[model samples]
Target: MQDKPVLKVVNLRKQYGSGCDHCDDGHEVTWEKNSCPECGTVYACNDVSFELYPGEILGVVGESGSGKSTMMKCLYFDNEVTSGEAYISSYNNGETNVFEESSQQLRHIRNTILGMIYQNPVLGLKMDFSSIGNIAEKMIAAGNRNVEYMENRSKALLKHVHIPISRIKDEPRKFSGGMQQRVQIAKALSNEPPILLLDEVTTGLDLSVQASVLDLIKTIRQELGISMIVVSHDLAVIRMLADRTIVMLDGKIIEQGLTDQILENPQHEYTQQLVYSLI
Candidate 1:
């Protein structure tokens, strides 16, 4: 039997601004219509949906403004959802729609269940704090009060991400860009979350650095059996990390399939162009 998905999302929508003439009529608004011709309204995400199974890596690929990041933000509770349901099997027995949860509950979920690595290291790491402190913060938030345990966990995770344990007390600002990213990865995994959300983790890095980070992610997945949703505009990143892929256009999923199938034989016109452009 196929393994049940660890996370499920349905008809997820996030919009900015009040109802417009088009929205008033209950007509579907395309992403291209950012500002309604009749009345201004921004549609950042509309009718997005997907599932992520345990130990599976789902790649969300699209150019800028395609709402890939917006969707992830909603999932991470960094942005609020306008409508739709998101369920995590490990949370509340998957009965509660995460979007409807109270802020406190959401905070608990974000702290304990979901791990996120931002494209910008500054956003993910506390530059003022030592690398160990950054990781310890997550552990502390999860109710882990044992100082020794937190320190050991942080050191082990740092080592796992290829950061030297000797630098445990060093500030993130002192690290290289790639190393800072590695530190963020270690912090995200500190709680041993069942799901990890990686947003353009390889962007703005040297080619060699990108490869090393990707290799680290692959190793983590193989060793820990973690489920991940990797978001990127770079097809190469998606191809390297994802088992299955979803192509988004104008805030909507236009195509989805196995990574190799989507890369080798794209079905949608936009996907075909995206694949060919990378060749």
Candidate 2:
């Protein structure tokens, strides 16, 4: 039998500003209509939905402003959803929609059940804090109080991400961009979360650095069996990491299937253009 999905999202919507006159007429918002010409409402994400199965890597790919990151932000609770339901099977017996949970419950979920690595390391890491300290922050949030335990956990995670133990005391700002990203990964995995959300993790890195990060991600998934939602505009990155893929456009999922299937036989016009452009 198929395993139950670890996470499920239904009819998710996130919009900026009140509904406008044009939107009231049943006009769907496209990327070009981000700001409604009639009433100036911005549709950052509209009726987006997907599921993440246990130990599966789900890739979300789209151009900038396609609402890929917005969808992730909503999942991570960085952006509040206007309407919809998100259920994580491991949380509260999977009966509660996280969007409707209290702030304290959301905080608990973010700390213990979910781990996220932002596209910008600066957003995810404390640049001035020692690498170990950064990892310790997550541990502490997860209720770890023993100094020795926190230290060991941090060191082990750093080593797992291939950061040398000797460099554990150095601040993130002292490390290279790629190394900082690695440190972020270590911190994200410090608590052994069941689900990981990675948004444009390789966006601005050098080609070589991107490859290394991708390899590290693969290793983490293989070794830890963590389910991940990887968001990126680069099809190559998605191709490298995801087993299944979802194609988003103008705040909606336009196509989705096995990664190879979508790449080989794109059915949507937008997906066809996206795949062809990668050539």
Candidate 3:
């Protein structure tokens, strides 16, 4: 890891609904999971903090509703964060808080500094647009007006992700689940962002297709050296891709360490269950 982080997030919090005195102060009052029953407030993400170093993959692993996906959304600006500070080294030299930036600035950051690959193909890709067109759409947002350059870049990226050149002009709707995801990967890379955020990229694929996508991710990391934050509920995925791992439950991190260390000797009960289940 480098001395300076590529991305740093501090005390990120996202909560739905107003809080009551019962759970507002120190959360001392009784609650179920992450919800404060008294006030109907859901603490989807509670003071999450972490860093992504240059050329490394940091995995956030947890079950559904554990806030991992919420955190990813907050990072990508798809969902607003209630409170937090996110510093990107490539954005204003890491001195400015990204969460406080203007919407226009956020758009620039999203288009230039960050690329997000959503779990659902529909969320990350346009089903109606051709695969290359999807990639061109992102490039267009990044201010690329040269048609030839965009076309060349799109074809190259699609081919890199194993999409056939013959099918590059086909709409994603005609592709298989895995092929659609590959096209999504190509589109996300259209901007050449320094940071890539992947949320459950392999969640719904078949076992073999999942392996292919996972391998493509590894190849991207090795070849491009782009920093990545991968969110998944599966430890196996984290174990294969992440340099470091954080285990979350109930919207809070309960355990974290190097993937090997966490797998070999989990410290939390929930983490232990996750590790043992791999057997």
Most TM-score-accurate candidate? 3
What alpha-carbon RMSD in Å does predicted model 1 have with respect to the real structure? 1.5
Clash totals for all models, in order?
0, 0, 0
Query: Candidate 3, residues 95-161: lDDT per residue as tens digits?
Result: 9999999999998898889999999989999899999999999998888899999999999999999
Clashes of 3: 0
Query: Positional deviation of 241 in candidate 3, in angstroms?
Result: 0.6
lDDT score of residue 77 within candidate 3 = 95
Tens-digit per-residue lDDT, 1-279, candidate 1: 137789999999888878676775768665344445556666678788889999999999999988999999999999999899999999988888989999999989989999999999998899999999999999999899999999889889988888886788999999999999999999999999999999999999999999999999999999999999999999999999999999998778999989999999999999999999998
True-vs-predicted CA distance for residue 17, candidate 1, Å: 1.1
Kindly give the stretch of ten consecutive residues in candidate 2 with the minimal lDDT sum. 24-33
* Model 2 agreement with the true structure over 9-102: per-residue lDDT tens digits: 9999898888866674666645254566667777788888888998999999999999999998899898889999999999987889999999
For candidate 1, list the clashing residue pairs, or say none: none
- Candidate 2 vs candidate 3: the lDDT winner is 3
C-alpha-based local distance difference test score of model 2: 0.91
Better of 1 and 3 by lDDT: 3
lDDT by candidate, in order shown: 0.91, 0.91, 0.93
